[model samples]
Target: MAGPPQQAEGSGSAQASGSSTARKTFELNNDVQVADPSDSLFAYSRDEERVLEDAAPWKKDPHYFHTVKISAVALIKMVTHARSGGAYEIMGVMYGKVRDGVFWIMDAAALPVQGTETRVNAGNEAFEYMVNFQTANNEVGKDEMLRGWYHSHPGYGCWLSGIDVNTQMTNQSFNDPYLAVVIDPNRTVSAGKVEIGAFRTFPEGYEAPQTSQYQSIPMDKIEDFGVHANSYYPLKVEIYKTRLDEQLLDLLWNKYWVATLSQSLISSNRAYATSQLADLGAKLHSAPLDASAKLKKKDEGVEDDATPLNQATQDSVRINTELQNGMTAQVIKEKLFNGKLDAEGARKAVLGVL
Candidate 1:
């Protein structure tokens, strides 16, 4: 799919022709600072000239203009999910903070969904995954707020469909600063570059001034579609990089190079299965041998005949098992504090005696 439509020239002027409302500027109070232009750690640069005041003509009536900044890791995750879906469409939710008019995307989670060429539905496990995600991330002093959603267009270009517009409208109504991002995975892979679009919907009953350059849609696809496909204004996206992201990119390059040489999905899966089976077989074989040895010792009336090496091995196993149990108890306690498990459940989980 092609990416979202680019903003036209002169579209950023805050003052629309004959408009009476004044442009408003907001200052953010959070720690989400804009990276310095001279910073070498960041991979992408923001277009300082493209402010919300200069939004597309269709979005002039919105109360405030919004800018979207995606973290390097978040952008990578989104693109990875899109590429994994291949020709099928995939959907996911974005986690971030909305400071002033700026939306910073900190992370993303791919929802459980089965997608076809045109539509993707959140799968049965999606709700459970979302609940777990919220519980794990929404800690004090954390910037992991639910911000918006994203999906892929596969072979189609990145313009919003009528259904997508409706979804965006509902999201914006409930979540101010909510954004909808569309990625064209096919284009990204083929072009060896990311192809994506960020957009915000206009308010209800808002009409755009007619333009001579606008083209009419064919009758079959236009029914009930209204101006939805054209109503959204594109938001400039900046993928800000961090030091950790640079390290991850270096590791990824090595992994991708290795993958290119001998990696096929089927072969990798088969190897994993074979390794697991071998481990299971080893455990199964050793268990019977140990039992038979114990039976023989009982028959010979040899009690407590462990050698020094065997005693040490037994001690090591017991210590390791106790350490695992302690870690499991700690995890249960944290889950209780996070309200993922009730007190009674936590008690049972941590102390079997309860």
Candidate 2:
């Protein structure tokens, strides 16, 4: 667990370090694994004019982020409508590529809320809600595609905050290469324009940035999301498999299902569709084209059962040598990959030495 906040501030500067300004660390739970090694950081952008058109009625604010994959969101019914601000949760998936990065996101059913305080961000629901969405992504499948997250900052320019850092670090403990996105709804100076900022932690330590660079990303370039030429706020993320290539389609499925699973697990307790996993497994097994190939790809390295762990279970594996009573990162990793140890067990074993 992380120590309590050293101090509090409306916003604090992140001391950036090697490679990037953002820094993070992830402590994986038994149900998930890092999706991409190359994606050690995150990024996002926005089309101001597009947002202006879509959020016209409510004058909505929007933000975007990157994760293990896109997600599924339930169209939240508005109990009491708010003219401006409220809160909401994002639902999405986590996916792993054969040799690349992971993607995270929310799906069609997602919606904004009117009021509520969440456990995340010191009672700030926004960031914590997103974190839960990511957790859901993991429970679904390992093949989800990352499309990034979207939400609106209260007002002013887009930037990361102290609470955002806390949330990001929480995510980092799960995996590196996650992104933080902030949307500013008060950029009235440009009316039809919106400002967005993307950030990622440095791979090593918390250092400062030399200077900031904001990159503009094409809406369509975001894997499965795109913009309508005539509109801004009401953009669309294509869900039909026929609209994408094989890799992109896989990305869509992984992103969508991960979000679905994540939300289901968190909201209900896997009671709704307990057999969803088995159904997916069956689909992979029975696909007419290359059932064997799919089965091999899907089942390879899969563990049908999980063993929970505690400190003693971890210490039990220690084989004293010239090193010590415990093991090194290498030894622990080797044991994990070789099935000699579980992820949690290995982590505890290593913590023993530290």
Candidate 3:
């Protein structure tokens, strides 16, 4: 299958994009700062001529945008909120400015909105809260503009849902140069990496080129993933940080190390694991155990991604890998926290797990 549409290549605005390789997760890296002090046109916190308020280039061309570079603090905050949501959904808005088709996500703050009990109504009050939030931000001098929104899917996977496509469409209608980001916290834990995707809906009546980028989604949600996969496309996401951001992360690594050693992510997310197994069983009932089975009949001129022999094979591989990863986490918890193994032994086992 063809992959998602790639960024236009070679120089000019395309040169502003990062590596073509997809980012599995955010990691602090030692790279040169984006802004150079000697050059005088850049600030550590701001980019030169970053905001293009006059022209809506993206409106003229849907493919104009290609990448999203989130700051260290922004990504940290997003994943933290996403994980906190656990099995339920949590939503937030991002703070950034657009330049050269990239969303420079500087910071993220959680909204009171969620798809669970205790979710604050996103009424006029939600707008009121955002205004107050921005007021507080301005007071502290972190006055970045809103560029996009982020939400968690919990376990389903990082793809836009029907509701998500409509929401993003409305946002794009009013908020050009906007983005919708999804984070799958449950998969992130199992994969030992951030499960994330950034997307923008196609304009109405616009026939987007057919492309597909596979995500290791839950078996139960595979249909939903397939049906809505074409409504929008994923952006090539990258992360950036200032030199001070790198220094702070290094200083905090010790704290994170201690926490990682003690926390059992699997134990905490047992509900998700149970649901995963249930989904696997449901998928197995509908899938052929024999991947080599030949189809008896097929619809003419209609391409079906699922229900084919190859799809069954791929699904089995994903299912087996999912269960294996879950078992590894369980073992890690047992050996590390349940007194089944010594600390050194457990630590060594965790190296491959993480």
Identify the leading candidate in terms of lDDT. Answer: 3
Relative to the true structure, candidate 2 has a C-alpha RMSD (angstroms) of 23.8
Candidate 2, 204-273: lDDT as tens digits: 2433333422222211221211111111111222111112232453444432432322221112312212
Q: Which structure among the candidates has the greatest TM-score?
A: 3
RMSD of each: 27.6, 23.8, 12.1
- Candidate 1 regions off by >4 Å? 1-63, 123-125, 139-143, 209-227, 247-354
Candidate 1 lDDT over 311-338, as tens digits, reads: 3344345334534544554455445445
**Candidate 3 local lDDT, 27-131, one digit each (tens):** 324333444222221242443433464567888888888998887778989999998987678888898877778777888999877576212225566678888
Cα TM-score per model: 0.51, 0.28, 0.74
Better of 2 and 3 by lDDT: 3
**Model 3 lDDT, full chain set:** 0.70
Residue 248 in candidate 1, Cα distance off native in Å: 5.3
The lDDT values for all models are 0.60, 0.31, 0.70
Arranged by lDDT, best first: 3, 1, 2
Kindly provide the TM-score of model 1 when superposed on the true structure, using C-alpha atoms: 0.51
